[model samples]
Target: MRAVILAGGQGTRLKPYTAVLPKPLMPVGDMPIVEILIRQLQSNGVDRITFALGHLAHLVQAVLGNGKRYGVEIDYSIEDKRLGTSGPLSLIRDLNETFLVLNGDVLTDLDFLDITRFHADQKSTITIACHKRSVNIDYGVIHRDGFRVTEYEEKPVIELYVSMGVYVFEPAVLSYVDPETYLDFPDLVNRLIHKNEQVKIYPYDGIWFDLGRFEDFNRVHEIWDDLKPKILSHE
Candidate 1:
């Protein structure tokens, strides 16, 4: 299978560390997060992988080399400038088949094979890996009917399923993205939906960390001892 890993982000959210290294290169446990993801992909039957690169592109290439050590063919697509998220896909060639695309900064034990199968079986244009997340409000929440206070609740929590930055795309969907300019994946997905294309979401109920935020980055170390084994185990 072929996959494109988005490694181009400047990772502004991760300040000082990103200032020196690309977010994908950030260390998690012993190996860099992207490296772990690459190994996971390889083990899951992805033989050809491309790194969509921009900021500190040279450093990343230097660190990962030809991907021989990882047992997969490594290739890259250079973004002359920042191209939002999925915009970099426009720069790659021969995406004429179903492919997997994802952000390199994420840490997850999700089975890529399952995702690929789901995409094929469903005949989907695009499938987003989703996870349910909840956020609680610390303050009391209030409901009002104009001039009257109707109800009040303390620290109400809101829950929603959010994209985990992993996706499967059929080559036909590539037409939706233009050659250049800033176009985020979310925008592209929405555009496809508006056009009545089949965009599916695959719910995930396992370990995941974006590592784009400071708290999440720290959480990796806190959970590594437990998460590592699950991620490494093929069974």
Candidate 2:
């Protein structure tokens, strides 16, 4: 299987830490997050990996060095200009089969092979891996019918299914990508929907974290010893 790791963003949200290193290169538990991801992919049946790179591309190249260390083949697709998440895929050639695309800074135990098989079994144009997250609202939320208040809830916890920045795509879905245009994943999903293509969601209730966010980054560090075994476990 093949996988594309999106490691290009400047990681503006990470500030000083990212100022010196690319977001994917940011260390978590003594290893670069992307390196850990590479190892996970290899364990999950991915032998070929491509890095969609931009900001600090050289540093990433220097650090990962062709993926041999992880027992996977690594290549790079550097963007001349900023291509939104999905745009880089259009620039990458030879994706004539089902493939995986995900953000490099993701830390999750979701089985890559399992999702790939799920996509194939469903015969979907794209399958997005989603996770359930709860967001707590601090203020009382009022539901009104015109001017009359119908309901009110105090400090409600809202449940939402959020993208885990991982996806399995069939080659047929590439028809929606325009090589000249910059596009993000959501917009591509919308386009697929507009065209009546099948898009599916694979909901996961596993331990997952988007290390791009500072809070998750810090939390991972706090719980690394407990989480590392599971995150990197081949089982």
Candidate 3:
């Protein structure tokens, strides 16, 4: 199977670390973030992979070099300019069959094979890997009825489902991606929904992290010793 990784982002959120290297090249555990994702994809039977890169593209190519050491053929699609999330896929002409695409900064233990199969079974044009997240408001949220006093909920944690930055897409979905413009994944999803196309979500209740901030980066380092055994076992 073929997989494409969106490694082109400037990762402004990651700041100093990204100032020197691409987000994908930032070390996570013992390997670079992109390397970890590559190993996971290989272990799950993805034989060929493509990197869609913009910032520090050469650095990524230099480090991952043909993906031979990792047992997968590595290819690249360089973006001369920034292509928001899903726009880079429009530049990869070889993607004819169903393929997997993901953000390079994510750290997850999701089973890629299972996601692919689920997409096939559902006959969905696009499938997103989703995670359930909760956030609590600092102040009380009041339900108002104009001039009437209503009940209020204080500091309640609200549960919401959000994209985990991973996706499986059939070739047909490419039609929605414009070749010359920057387009985000959510925009494509919205268009798909408007067109009544089948879009599926695979909820993952597993270990996952979006290493896009300094706090999360530090947290991963703190827990690396404990998580290494399990992560290495999978590799």
What is the per-residue lDDT of model 3 for residues 72-171, given as tens digits with 9 covering 90 to 100?
9999999998779989988999789999988998888888989999999999999999999999899988888996759888898999999999999999
lDDT of each: 0.90, 0.92, 0.90
lDDT, model 2, position 205: 99
Model 1 Cα lDDT, one tens digit per residue, 21-119: 998888998988888888889999988899999999999999988899999999999899889998999999789888999898888889999999998
| Candidate 1, backbone clash total | 0
Clashes of each: 0, 0, 0
What are the clashing pairs of model 2? none
Which residue pairs clash within candidate 1? none
Instruction: List the lowest-lDDT window of 10 residues for candidate 3.
Output: 226-235
What are the TM-scores, per candidate, against the unseen true structure? 0.94, 0.96, 0.95
Worst 10 residues of 1 by lDDT: 226-235
Pick the winner on lDDT between candidates 2 and 3.
Answer: 2
lDDT by residue (4-106, candidate 2, tens digit) is: 9999899988998899899998989899899889989999999999999999999999988888878999999999898898888888889988899999889
lDDT of 2 at 50: 94
By lDDT, the best candidate is 2
